[model samples]
Target: MEIKEVKQRKEIIEPLLEVWQKSVRSTHHFLNEKEIVMISQYVPSAFENIPHFIVGYDEQKPIAFMGIDGERIEMLFIDPICQGQGIEKN
Candidate 1:
């Protein structure tokens, strides 16, 4: 496992979006299906505005990612299959 800063937004946007949807669906059960769909549409553009983004990988596959804005963490998501593996804790 390794953690690294993301230098290119386009490179992992799709996978990160998948991770985001999965993570949100599993955790944010309060959101309706329509709400999820609505939010999904904006994820790409919102990600582009994140000032600092990083990803965690196992081998060559991305397992988790985080977006930070100064001292605040805007987003942190882990692939559903990769959850509870302490990827976020590290």
Candidate 2:
């Protein structure tokens, strides 16, 4: 496994969005269907504005990602299949 900085936001946007949606659906049950849809509409633009992004990979497959803006973490997501593997800890 390895962690690498993401230099191109567009390159992984699709997979990143997939991971984000799956993660949110599994974890953020407080959000109603309408809120989920609204947030979904905004995620892409938010992703575009993140200044720092990194991805965790197992071999060549991306398993998790985190986005940072200065000191605050804007996003962190793991592929549901890869959850509980402690990818977030490292």
Candidate 3:
């Protein structure tokens, strides 16, 4: 697996959105379908506003992503299948 910064946020928004939704659903059991859909509406804009964006790839396929603002991590979502694989620590 390789983790790299994404210069163009657009390049990873769609794939990361899929990762974000899948991850949220799998882990955020308190959220309902409607709530998830509502929150998803803002995901792309959030990506746009993030100062630093990075993605993790496995075999050149997107598997995880993070959005950083200054020294804080604003967002992080890993594909459900890929979680617990040490990608976050990497």
lDDT of each: 0.87, 0.83, 0.90
Query: TM-score per candidate, in order?
Result: 0.91, 0.85, 0.93
Clashing pairs in 1: none
How much is the lDDT of residue 9 in candidate 2?
Answer: 76
**Which lDDT value does model 1 have at 51?**
91
State the lDDT of candidate 2 residue by residue for 1-90, as single tens digits: 899898777877777778788888888999987888788888877778889888888877777888899999988888888889777888
lDDT of 3 by residue, 24-69 (tens): 9999999999999999999999988888988899887889999899
Span of 10 residues, lowest total lDDT, candidate 3: 6-15
Task: List RMSD in Å for every model shown.
Answer: 1.1, 1.6, 1.0
RMSD of 2: 1.6
Sliding window of 10 residues with minimal summed lDDT for model 1: 7-16
Q: Which pairs of residues have clashing backbones in candidate 2?
A: none
Model 2 reaches what TM-score against the true structure?
A: 0.85
Residue 66's C-alpha lDDT in candidate 3?
A: 90
